[model samples]
Target: MRELKPWLDLIFKRPGRLVVGGFLILATLLSGIALLAVSGWFITETALVGLLLAAGVAATINLYVPGGAIRFFAVSRTVFRYLERVYNHDTVLRLLTDIRVALFRRLSQASRIRRGELSGAQWLSRLTSDVDALDTLYLRLIAPAALAGLVTLAVVVLAAVLFDVGTALLVGLLLVIALLIATVGVYLRTWRLSARQSDRQEDLRTAVIEHIEGFPELTAAGRTGKHAAWLMRQAHQVTSEQAKADTRVGWHLAGSHLLVNLSAVVALWAGFALFQAGTVSGPVLVLLPIALLGLAEVYAMLPDAFGKLGATLASASRLNRDCREDKQPGTPKAAGLPPETALLAENISVKHSGYAPLFTRFNLEIESGERVGILGHSGSGKSSLADVLAGLLRHAHGSLARTDCVYLTQKTVLFEDTLRANLLLGSPEASDTELWGILEQMELAERFATEPDQLDTWLGSAGSRLSGGEARRVALARVLLNPAPLVILDEPFTGLDAETRGRVSKRMETLLEGKTVISLAHGSEALPGTDRVIYLSG
Candidate 1:
């Protein structure tokens, strides 16, 4: 339950939406119950009136009243059902949007090391499967269960008034047990199976993804057949467990329906005594039992939802664990610096988890409008330093200050979107002309211009459509679009040939005319124009 508190709080933010959606659902259920109960009453009344007329006994009954009620309920049932479907589905989509946005925000706030525990397949599962389970919590579980209880109470009261308190109590007791079977009993019986379904599915997903990625290697080693068979077995296991869960839910549903029928049977049996004694009319006595039967539809919604309750709890628990905020204790934040300094670091110590300190008590200060280059080989922690400066690697024990900065990490990252859309991430308000200008400086304008869609061309997954150098240039152009005072480039010229790198590097000096820039690379030749160069020993 504690695992669901944060997500529940997020859900309750739209209280008005929840209330209106619940009202629509309740209205639909009531219309359905009324339609059946009134139809049953009308049939019994008409049959009695017909028998009286046939026996030559004078009888008077208004046909118009019951007929009109039956018509009204019938029409109301369809109309409310349609309206609830439209209104509730729209609410669900909005809730999905809210939940996805919140989850992304929390993931972003988490530390990079903690976030790294999630792999590509795991991230996909969390975002789609786990988040999906929680988004439908209101529509599927909470509203239906609450309304079932309310409608049950209403039916029990009807029984008490039309029959007797003793009859009503008997009926209510059976119905309560049935409700328990549908909700709490189902949850208790199936939670362990349902709760671990997510884990099973996640494992299968990881295995399938890894298998596909390593298929060529397996084929080369003449082991592809065996590996594929293992994946099939994993998939089969997941399906088998899911089938078991469904079977349990089905059994619970059947049991609950049996108890509901027993309640209706109890009411009909008790009402006969009342009918014989003239305590109630035949039509009215028939009404209580028929209405008790209507509750079967109400309780029908509970078992399936409660059977999946364990999976929902598991999902909530995973989300809570993954999205916990990363706290850096006793690490003082960098304060405002002197006007001349663009970046300041004092007694900075940097290291990754479970390793020796990469560097200790390192100090550096760069002034405004200066270009400084730091050269370090592959294993010299240059990228970690870059992350520390960018405030992405938060565990570093130091005081660091810098103006707003844009960083081009060593690893190029681009979404599967249009080239223009990817570039606009750096400056959302950038015009086409400004974007073209940046591309021309990177020497990629001519390359993309040859394509039919040019800037609109899709980059594919992680810029897979383009060559390595082209992708690197597109990423660099994005960072260059930002108007921040400080810029950090870690291996910015990667994947480009010597000629292209020199041309782009020479062009970048003009674009970076007045900004304070820090370029990190393995050698001086890989760096852009810099006033001073610093080197680190391995």
Candidate 2:
């Protein structure tokens, strides 16, 4: 929860927009209340005057003023409602942007330290669904609660001026009780239900993702039906939890409505008593009930808003845990070294969280303009070594010094964007000619040249439009564009055929001529023109 301070600060940084949005919300709620009250008084007064005139009694009344005031409030309510939606939505969108940026930045920094705790599905949920839940905090919770309070205060003051201090106190007390029932009572009763529903929803999401991604494996293993049954069970569980939550929310809403109606009835009875005592005029007495009715609209949303608090807090807590870094005492820090020395490690030992040490008393060094190949068997720390050198993993004990390096992991990542746009991630200032140059170096120039749009072709989500081999080449091309002196390629040609691998390996040697390259692969034959090879075995 404390990790949320940075995001909260970012949201309130632009107080002007927040203040204006709040003012618009307040204006809309108040205008609606005023419109109903004024309409009621005008109609009652006009009817009484008409009756007096019919009895041959002259009555002096100004219809123009009340009629104009009603018109003003009616128009203002509609206009303010529209403006409030537009302005508040815009503010929410801006806040979402800031939150996403802050969350991504924090995750990027803490990923190396908290890698074990953040699985693929959990990471996806935190970045997308969890971050999105925050909008409800502003739009649904804070804004509506604020508007209800403001309207309640206005109604109490109006009641006092129209009737007496005792009437004002009664109205205020009822409104306060209604608010407490909607917020505190609903929260206390429904929070556990909301949390259960949220948990089931996440389980359903994970189950569906697994079913889709593992469809081929399940079919091959003759367990497709079993997997399908499991998915159905998860779906049923989510539906059951959702039903329970909805039932609780329905009851809470019904109770809130009853309280609001009770308040309105009490206001009406008090107004009637004042009228019989001749303390309040007929028009004012009619206005009181209508104004109370308007208040129902404000209080109606409180039950659901408060019911969502549990889920919102749960999301915040999860995101905070993922984003916050846990620094270990006495953790080894990389030493500063000369730019010409690409890497140096002495007596280094590394281990994953809750796992045995992968590298014990390991020593390695690479100079500038050197190409080194790391060959190891499965579970022999090939990829782990790359991660450590790239500063993506912290070693438990080591004296390591390295220049900045660019890493191309086993999985190729491409966005839903033009080829040029993806390439620009490596070198933002690179021009079209430079991008094409790198593509040619990676043997992908002919593939894009045949496309109708060339560099402007839209690579569908996750580069789904490209073949596996083509996507790998694009990733390699992007890596080639990076200006970092030390380049780490982890299983770069996994899906390519033997012939293609040879061509790509040769081209990589040519493209990475002046840079320090550390190629991690299963066999030394995969790396061409390797100056040296280090084989790791347990």
Which of the numbered candidates is closest to the native, going by highest TM-score? 1
Which regions of candidate 2 are displaced past 4 Å? 1-7, 112-119, 220-230, 326-335
Q: If scored against the real structure, what TM-score would every candidate get? A: 0.96, 0.93
Error of 1 at 51 (Å): 2.1
What lDDT does each candidate get?
0.89, 0.82
TM-score of 2: 0.93
Q: Report the backbone clash tally of model 1.
A: 0
Q: Which ten contiguous residues of candidate 1 have the minimum total lDDT?
A: 326-335
Tell me, what's the RMSD of every candidate? 1.9, 2.5
**Candidate 1: where is the Cα deviation over 4 Å?**
328-334, 450-452
Task: Look at candidate 1 and give me any clashing residue pairs.
Answer: none
Position 458, candidate 1: lDDT: 95
In model 2, which residue pairs have backbone atoms overlapping below 3 Å?
none
